[model samples]
Target: MLKNLAHAHTQKFGKGFNVCNLNNMRAFFLAFSIWNALRSKLSWTHYRSFAG
Candidate 1:
């Protein structure tokens, strides 16, 4: 199922649509949403490692 979704994403979005990239994208958005809720003033660079 994940492979199918990744293949579709690759076709639609171009390269770097593998499982790791997909999971990273998900983690980024999840972290972004949480940051928005908390209104963190920290720079993204500072928390980038935590995001991934």
Candidate 2:
């Protein structure tokens, strides 16, 4: 099912809209969620520096 959905999206959108990008997006969201949950565990400045 997921493969079919990806194929359909690629047919409409062309390249750069593939499984690798989808996985990267998933990882980004997962990281964002983890960051949100830990926002208060450390200083905002520390996080900003680490982000850089």
Candidate 3:
């Protein structure tokens, strides 16, 4: 869950989050950033593994 991760990161890092919340609301809880990340996680990981 991005919410839990973001919460943990916010608590750990303390302010200055680069979270840019967009106004495009689709689902009740789905944010634009999170939706994109979840959609691309698999390919992103694959690309990272190959690159690294």
Candidate 4:
């Protein structure tokens, strides 16, 4: 399912939709499932680091 989703996203968006990236995105979403819990002052890099 991820492979198919990634392929379709790549076909439409043209880049940055590989399996590894999809997995990272899934992990990020799982880690931060609560939108209200996210800190607005933090950058994406900070959030990514936290997710990692």
lDDT of 4 by residue, 1-52 (tens): 9999999999999999999999999988999999899989998899799999
Which segments of candidate 3 are over 4 A away from where they belong?
Answer: 18-52
The lDDT of each candidate is 0.76, 0.63, 0.43, 0.93
User: Model 4 clash tally?
Assistant: 0
Residue 51 error, candidate 3, Å: 20
List, residue by residue over 1-52, the lDDT tens digit for candidate 3. 5556556767888754323221112221332334544544466445344333
> Rank by lDDT, descending?
4, 1, 2, 3
Q: For candidate 3, give the lDDT.
A: 0.43
Lowest lDDT 10-residue stretch of candidate 3: 20-29
Give the C-alpha lDDT of model 4: 0.93
* lDDT (10s digit) by residue, model 1, range 1-52: 7789899989999999998877876877887765456446766565568786
**lDDT tens readout by residue for model 2, 1-52:** 5567678889998876677666655555555666546656776456545543
RMSD for all candidates, in order, please.
3.3, 7.3, 10.5, 1.2
| TM-score for each candidate, following the candidate numbering | 0.61, 0.45, 0.30, 0.81
Alpha-carbon RMSD, candidate 3: 10.5
| Top of the candidates by lDDT | 4
